[model samples]
Target: MSAEQAESEPQADLPGPPPGPAPPSSAPPSSAPPSPMQRAVQNYLRHVTVERGLSTNTVAAYRRDLALYTLWLAGEGIDDPSGVTGNHVGAFVQHLGTREVEPLKASSIARVLSSVRGWHRFLLEEGQTETDVAHETKPPKLGSRLPKAISIEQVEALLDATRGDEVQQLRDCALLELLYATGARVSEAVNLNVDDVIDQEVVRLLGKGGKQRIVPVGSFARAALDAYLVRARPQLSLRGTATPALFLGLRGQRVSRQNAWLIIRAAAARAGLDIEVSPHTLRHSFATHLLAGGADVRVVQELLGHSSVATTQIYTLVTADTLRDMYTSAHPRAR
Candidate 1:
């Protein structure tokens, strides 16, 4: 039987343990089979996870967004991918806006719509549907916001704050230095192996969609890594089972993205900086500083492992604003 037909068929009841308290009458049975639309969503999720090689967080986001979409489709009595239409997709967008608790922002709504569009496109390409109904459903426009970057002095202070001979402190210092030096996403940095950096001048980073790129290590960061590996990592490694991770938590396993964020925040607090700092803040500062120092945008893009130079060009806006502020303050003008 076809997968959908098999799913629709009622299963043979077998003897089981006595039931507990009855569920509310309004609730559907827990064993209810998934609709055909839901099955398609599962297929698409697997495709992205396995074939597309998207990161865990990215795959989770796609799953969440698509789950909501399928639930909405079921409410509308649309149980098949072929049954969806542009009007249905548009109505779903409207339904999202009408949500009462913690309404989504325009950017968030746009992201949901983007997910929906990708799903429909996938369905069409897979021959599961005749048309991509969501093709014309436009996402809400988002206003441009420049990336936030701290001054060079602020960055130096933050890095300095992580300095100490303690095991965790050595790891933190090296972590922050590598972050500012390489512009790696926190996930990429935390996911690193010891061999990825040890005895190498260039660090290999595995970015989104399993794309790999090499970024050169600066002298300061290299020195920090050498110290951490020599004095700190050996001690940390003995705390738990053996692992090849470059950075380790107190448990001796790989440091997590959350832990890395905490490291950055604690350092920022110690540095007495009033601004919020996260791992991405260092990445932004890295790009901004490079552009401000007259580095070529294309070169920065390569270093950043950005798939397109357009993504790197955003830093130029930050640099331009900085130059404008400097010009207004330094140059004699008839104002």
Candidate 2:
């Protein structure tokens, strides 16, 4: 074979480049034409972003998976949608997980497989391909993970450690209180508008899929929020253009998720807690504590803005584990 042709062949023995940062999206540029495979990938990326309304981070992940898949296809001399087959997709899955260098974890590979399956479906829907080679492909099974939660005592300690008169401290106190009180996701908490807190009795949260729900705020959360709004927010709100966001950073912009995380971590460190605490840790503690206190699962589900009770059911597992631990330690006959 000519050297050029030889270079084009798939190198099963050669490890591909180590996984790198995700490339710029291949969404069809108005200025530059694309190859057939590139056009299909671009269309799918556009579909996920514009039509599906996936978050920027999620869209970036899809872009990364598809870009890697495209590179693998090029090596295999398969440039068009029609050139793909089930065997080819299966091989790609193996390559993603077992590559000598930079092998992906099973969870990561599962995500890549999900992205590939989505892209293939998009190709079939757009009529770019006659067959869906990924129709039968299955994601690798992932181990079940319980939500990480700090004990109620630890949570109380963390909250106490964050108490202060500084504007940022007040904001952090209120933020943490709301997160635990309402089981709000970090994104949901940060995205709150000034008016979302109603009469300081309850707060309206815009959850995933644009769904809104009203959750009653406990007295502590309500008090903290009232203090922040009256004492601290006005000060923090002075630095940037006025926004409707309930929480503001020092720059007066809405607090980013990273900022919320740092606030929680700082509080955890001040409390001298050993566990890694995140905003979601507060949410978990909220649900688990409510469950342990006899709140209904469905009520917790509504409060947490979960679309399905099945998703909310995981907290039951957490409570059960807690019970088992207590039993093991307290009941001598059980031992």
Candidate 3:
């Protein structure tokens, strides 16, 4: 697929299934030991999970991508790491692109190739392979796409949609408020504990790679949170076992990421928003609105917990576009 096609395609919540037929079923019982290639993949996964401190979702994506790579290797009658060559690696890339059924987009293919490259590098370092054949291989270059963000008015409408006196309503309001206030990923927001926010001006968030960062809470969000904690949470907590989680489900257990998504969707629908609004939309709006208000890009980077300022710079593009639009409409000499 072309880079433009990759940019246009909507990615799944998790990486999609690998190209070609499904990998060998682990369902059937097998007494035989795993192949050398299989063992190498497992070791690499363990390294990433434990040593690298990758998130569970990230490790799962790596597992899916490598499963396809190993299956393709077996199809070519090569089961050992040392037996694979650069030519084989190149051919596998072709295989991913040429598959007729559910062909992967260029971006998806690129992500899978990244998984393959990481595994090969691991093998070379551990002396399981004589050379890193996949080293020279490269993924397709992806086209840059701007993130979508709603206006401040739209965000207010969405937040207002959740306002009510009921326990669920108060909880939903606080959840949405916290998301916008902190620019947190849904996973990070749902993983928060009561102690992370209680009696504090700032909230603590655990981000990718187990990195922690502190972000200040806006008064609007703080008020909503206070209402939930004071009135709603106590009632909800009575339903189930004690836990440190700040957000609770109907059963009083910690809310899940999926549940958080549903809350955002329902609120968006109630607010009559025409555009799609995921948790990431709030994050995008948070960053974009901050930039538009003259906040330093570096400060926004820190607030969002982005390791690289370059990633945070993308929101500036959105603000730039908005500026161009305003200039064209307002300036009489501008054409």
The whole-model C-alpha lDDT of candidate 3 against the native structure comes to: 0.92
Q: Tell me the TM-score of model 1.
A: 0.88
Arrange candidates, best TM-score first.
3, 1, 2
Please report the candidate that would top lDDT against the real structure.
3
lDDT of all the models against the reference? Answer: 0.89, 0.89, 0.92
Give a tens-digit lDDT track for model 2, residues 246-315.
9998778798887788888878888999989999999999999999999999999989989899999999
Reference-based lDDT, residue 277, model 3: 90
Kindly list the per-residue Cα lDDT of model 1 for residues 3-94, writing each as its tens digit.
12322345789988678985568965599888788789999998999889888899899888988888888899889999999999998888
Number of backbone-clashing residue pairs for each candidate, in the order shown = 0, 0, 0
**TM-score to true structure, per model:** 0.88, 0.85, 0.89
**Tens digit per residue, CA lDDT, model 3, 1-335:** 42123323455798889899988987987789998988999999999999999999899999999999999999999998889999999999989989988888899999999999999999999988889999999887788889999999999999999999999899999999999999999999999999998475799999999999999999999999999999999998998899999999877778888778888888898899988899999999999999999999999999999999999999999999999999999999989
What's the lDDT for residue 319 in model 3?
A: 100
For model 1 the local lDDT of residue 69 reads 86
C-alpha-based local distance difference test score of model 1: 0.89
Candidate 3 minimal-lDDT segment of 10 residues: 1-10
Candidate 3 residue spans exceeding 4 A from truth: 1-29
Between candidates 2 and 3, name the one with more favorable lDDT. 3
The residue-level lDDT of candidate 3 at 177 comes to 98
